[model samples]
Target: MTSFIRVVKNLLPVILLVVVASSAQGADALPSWSEGKTKQSIVAFVERVTAEGSADFVPVPERIAVFDNDGTLWAEQPMYFQLLFALDRVKVLAPQHPEWTSKEPFASLLKGDLKGALAGGEPAIMQIVMTTHSGMTTAEFDQIVRDWIATAKHPKTGQLYTKMIYQPMLELLAYLRANGFKTFIASGGGVDFMRVFSEEIYGIPPEQVIGSSGKTNFEVRGGTPLLMRLAEINFIDDKAGKPVAIHQHIGRRPIAAFGNSDGDLQMLQWTCSPPGPRFCLFVRHTDADREWAYDRASSIGRLDKGLDEALNMNWTVVDMKTDWTKVFAFEQ
Candidate 1:
């Protein structure tokens, strides 16, 4: 008993030190975010809405925050990661569909001529999307996506696609959730594809993820119920569709919105325009060294009008190069 008491006495200061350090860490919720106005604004907004008795205080149930996935939550440099996934899926599925060897976009893809494959424009892209995303049970598709994302690597960084998620955004999501905010994904990526990984990566469940989707057909095969993806267009959740989807899915206006491109402009506008305390933030990809940097002219994740509006409206704009202490989780 004496020895145990002596040991406890020795460890008491260390335990207290650890507790104090943890408290300090928790005090600054966004550790990956650099000390700047952008970070300050985010922290301030969260505090204002979460503080009890404050005029801007939002009820816990109404503290909704939506985030765009691709370029906002993760890197979408060379192209959207889902497009890369589709290209890889084509290569894997080509043996089963030998006709793809001669098909225009498929042929170009199989020949490693990316430019040629996409040159046909939306029609070509739709064909690719339909070919890869349809004709499978939701469970089967989920497993396939799970398998692919588990091993897929980003072309430029060679990091696992999951590892490419932005560290700062991850912290922000956690910070908001910690403050009683319900974080959701409102992205342009495929709903099924993003659902498979959103919860694991962003702490958002499948139902909370809103995005472009292919149609699904309900069927019962041999007493087994299943929903099979179909090769047809369904609702697209992008640009103007974001607020509409949010209304349909969440049934409440979000207090905060985060995004990176023109596709997100309307979502930000909708979130901030309501007659209540609101926060809108756009992430500007400005770090060419740490990550690819392109805006306005970029084919993928183009910021264009969103950047202009954010500047004009005085909405918080996070400069990835200036605001983030680290880009990827792997950096730490």
Candidate 2:
């Protein structure tokens, strides 16, 4: 063999090894996540928890990871998506209820005075929700929510609400699942409303989701059994209620929790307060240019209390602008 040909053949194994190593590295667990401390911390935590015979290793069944939907998995800015659905439903049901034409909040809403309508606070908002959400079968409500989310566009962004989900989070969820973690969504959004799309959007089945809910009754309609939605409030799964709902639904405590608002404080606390190894994450909405930049002052998904506790407790806080290279899947 020629000297030059022999040299090329001798280097072939090294070149192939380099290509294989590069390919493995390129297949990152969190592609949208930048190479930073945040990513390193997450990877290290997962490794520790999943490694066989490791001190922090958790069983596959006990690898529960809970995530808040709004502002955590997706955008909640402008307003909660459920509230927007309620508003749209009100418009659709307006002609049926002529009383809304002269009502306080409804009248303002019908007149395009959104600010005035929401000025009455939770009471008025509840009124809208009960009126539009109730008096219908659970199946009917599900269809309504599904239909609305399919077509509704964010007032400002003009993009589908589901499209606003953080891209890095999708990768995180998949990564955790790959490591034998069972992911769930624990949010303050309406349970039925979220169930309409949670499985499709987040890969979380309806049974694994915990959220606020209203009373329901079994009724016979056209000789078929149906669950009729009631106006009475059954539960509010926000703030302190998050942990309560988690206990009621999930039974065991989550080893990891992810959220973006003060409403999720209790859930994160519950996850991290235990003695064993745990992970708590808070998504800081800091990318105003790419998405939104609000925390303390925002009426929707306010992160003030959670932010303070996260810093003081040393919980992982993901800085959207710095830690994430791409905010949305669409960007990639």
Candidate 3:
């Protein structure tokens, strides 16, 4: 053939090599995560543990990873998403509970005064949750949560609650799972409420999700057996309760733990304290432009002691503004 045609054919392999290299580079497991120590630490930890014959190599069955919901897995700013669900529920059941119109927290919620409703702290939140979440069968409550989560939108972002999940975290979960790690969610969020969307949104099944829960009792309603949710707390899986629930539900200590606030400090301590290789990650919400910026002083998802401890222990604390190339999946 001509000299020009021979030259093009000879250069094809070099061009192909460049294309292959570019493709491999673009195939990052965490596209949403920026290249930094925060990302490197996570990748390095997974590699060491999953590598055969490595000192830190952990067996597949022993490779359990737990994540906290709320601010950890999804957005919790503008108040907890569960609280928003309860508030909407109150309006739906308003005609039945006229007394709520005059109640302290309920009244404030009905009047769109969120600050006043939350003034009573945990007690007020508990009251609202019980009122809206109880007096129904477990199946009924499940359907309610499913329906609400499917349609609910964050007031600030105006995006569906599920869409508010951190894209980087989703990548981490998938990457870990691909490496034979079993992922679980241990959060302060209500178990049933989270179960409704955990599998759908995070690829974590309901059985793998552990959270705070209310009491439930078996009953024969209309000749059908069912569990009736009671208006009382069975467990509050936050702080110390997280470790307890993980122990009870999982029956094994996890090798990795992820959380964002003080509520998750105990879980992190428990996971990393044992004499073995462990990974503890704390996602610090430092992006006000893309998401939110709050830590020590914020009423919700406050990261006070956890922040100090993370530094002292040299635990991985993700600076959202720095570590994450993108926060939510909606972002370009």
**After TM-score superposition, what is the CA distance of residue 285 in candidate 2 from its true location, in Å?**
0.6
Model 2, global lDDT: 0.91
> Tens digit of lDDT per residue, candidate 2, span 1-332?
59999999999999999998898656888989989888988998999999999999999989999999999999887888789989998889999999988997999999999999999999999989988889989988888888888999988788898887888999999899988999999999889989998888888899988999999999997999999999989999999999899989988899999999999999999999968889999999999988899999998888998999999999999999999999987773
lDDT of each: 0.92, 0.91, 0.94
TM-score for candidate 1: 0.92
Q: What residue pairs clash in candidate 3, if any at all?
A: none
Query: Candidate 3: where are CA atoms >4 Å away?
Result: 1-26
Superposed by TM-score, candidate 2 places the C-alpha of residue 251 at a distance from the truth, in angstroms, of 0.9
TM-score of each model, in listed order: 0.92, 0.92, 0.92
lDDT for position 287 in model 2: 95
Ordered from best to worst lDDT, the candidate numbers read 3, 1, 2
Q: Which candidate is the best by lDDT?
A: 3
* Candidate 1 RMSD computed on C-alpha atoms after optimal superposition onto the true structure: 3.9
Cα lDDT for residue 258, model 1? 97
lDDT against true structure, model 3 = 0.94
Better of 2 and 3 by lDDT: 3
Tell me the spans in candidate 2 whose CA falls farther than 4 Å from its real position. Answer: 1-26
Q: Any residue pairs clashing in model 2, and if so which?
A: none
Give per-residue CA lDDT, model 1, range 1-332, as digits (tens): 99999999999999999999898657877889999899999989988998899999999999999999999999887888888889999988899998988888999999999999999997999889888988899899999899999998988889999999999999999898988999999999999999999998888999999999999999999999999999999988989999999999999999999999999999999999969899999999999999988898998888999999998999999898989999997874
